[model samples]
Target: MILHIGQQKSGTTYLQEVLGHVAGPLAETAGILYPASIREVLPDAVESHERATSGLLGTEYPWISAERAADERAKWPRLMARVRAWPGTALLSAEALSTIRSPAVARVAAEFAGAEVAVVVTTRSLDRSLPSLWQQHVRNGRVSTVGEFFDLLARQRDRGPAAIEREHGLHLWRAFALGGLVRRWAAQVGPERVRVVVNPGSPPDLLWRRFATAIGARHCADLPSDDVRTHRAHRGLTHVEAELVLALNRAIGEAGWSRYEGRAIREEILQHGLLPRTDRGPRVAVPMPARKRVAAWAEEDLADLRATGVRVVGNLDELQCSAEPQDVDQPPVAPEEVAQAAAAAIMAVASRDRYAPALRRRGWRARLGSRA
Candidate 1:
């Protein structure tokens, strides 16, 4: 089976899209399969959990928090079994799985397939991951300020961060690290079997060529490479917007990201988050020290990765051990917030829609409103 593991926002979608050779495939020959079937049953399986965190568990996007216990594991095994039946290599990927902190989840995932697994995880640098991750934390209402967010993460290193993860129930550090994931998966498939798909800022062809080789896919050339940016969840929140949302979260504290009276207020704070992050904003800085400290863990984790003895496909050099491909802003809206805003935004849309009839005749002049 060809597994495309994701630490999220790490080009997992682009990689899958590339592998599938979809509208824009990655390699010319290789195929990447996504786990679409899981969606249907996943909702039903997690319905109980959703009851407690329904607003956060909306179907507009499939995101499961780390707090999910064993009972929360997805019900896509039957789908995977079908994918496994296929003759060619199958790529099953979910950024959510990247958050599987339990050693057991890794083992059970492999055991369910009744096969040894080859894990292909793509990674980027901490400098790059932060801006993306920070926005996600903001969206979830876990962080409030870039400086303060950095402080929280710094505490993870100095004062020790279990406090935050304890409070927030997510591990920004572990969840975002490929080597850390490799360590977990290695327990199930053996380290020699784990393959790390390098996130080089280079041309996709070269990267894909290397990735396929390490994974032993016969059709590497068949897959396509994508240069378009993936992991858009971290694209556009400006410092001001991020800080505003973070402040709201801080004030709200635990259950901050949760809906207040069925309304996702913090999410609204981030819905149009990219509007003001103009090119003229504060210049970017070198990643904080805590970021580098996180990067430091890769060396040991990677060593464990190589021990798996599985086919090492790509040019390891091309892979980014600790990357900084430039931090793309988080998406203007967090995925879940986008769904929530869609509901609350209808009034704004209604007001604008009134002009649609006349504007449809006028074209570009149509649909302007309160939120516009």
Candidate 2:
């Protein structure tokens, strides 16, 4: 069975839809079976098997620091069992599972899948990724300012991968990015067995061709690059609008929220959704010095990171995106200070009171509640 683990938001959706929809024709030639409930049925097995051993359940979904889960997963042996059971290649695509959760998950997953499984993955630049990621979080009601957003970035790095995974649990990198995560898989599965695809906006059939080549399913006939239907992503939010929305998120506070209620915010973004990529709005610029500090940190990490066979798509120069430095030796921006300023600005638009209840309502507290 060949497993295609998605590193999320990395064209995995497009891949899933494309692969699934064409599975019939692909299977007819490739001789693989993608049963109707493939995505549903196996993930449970992965989860249940992992849960059975780890004894930890949902402190957070996609929890990577799940030592127990990892341990349990190592012991569960379902990937192996499934591999042993299946005849043709089995493709298990869980974007969340793409990261380096545990070396064991890769080892056992590939071991059981037989010597054949090649992990197919896609990646993008972090800068290009930030805007999309912010929009995604906001859709899910995670409203963090540019400064706080960077704060979390700094913290995540200091804490290490597992910690970050348990905390934020987004960033396809948490599951699979070209860093150690993919390296671990490649190391175990063999570099040849782990095929990394450059997204480069290839047409679906082209992508399918690449995938077919990787999975040894080249025989799966395909030439209809034109007939394939591609779903253009919904319109994106303007930079200002995105900032405004996330800022409003700070006002919601931890009092409470409804899952469905946020639909309006998303709908508004889509309805009015046009990403004026050039729409520059309120920016959170860190002092130049702080940027240097972050740059230093990243360089340190990069040193270690480079030692391993991992690929970093963006430059260290770009990695300090969160640090909008004023000077070459400044401290990172403080979120509370930023919150106070932002809240005050928001209050200016509210009724006469300097302390806008709405502003406080939407602050960090609200972010916490959303997380809760």
In terms of lDDT, which candidate is strongest? 2
> On residues 1-372, what C-alpha lDDT tens digit does candidate 2 reach at each position?
556665555566666655656666766677665543334556422221224223222223444455545554543354445545666766656555554355445444644543555666665334334445556666566777555665666665667666644444544445523455556576766655666554544343555565666666776636234454344333344344555566556555453556455555445443443233243334333334335545455455445445655433323343333445233232443555445434444444445455456667669657867999
Cα RMSD (Å) per model?
9.4, 11.7
* Model 2 ranges off by over 4 Å: 38-86, 103-115, 160-173, 201-209, 218-230, 233-236, 251-255, 268-372
TM-score of 2: 0.58
Model 1 vs. true fold: TM: 0.59
The local distance difference test score of each candidate is: 0.49, 0.50
Worst 10 residues of 2 by lDDT: 44-53
Candidate 1, lDDT over the whole model? 0.49
The sequence of per-residue lDDT tens digits that candidate 1 reaches over residues 115-167 is 55676776655554566677666666564556566676656545333442233
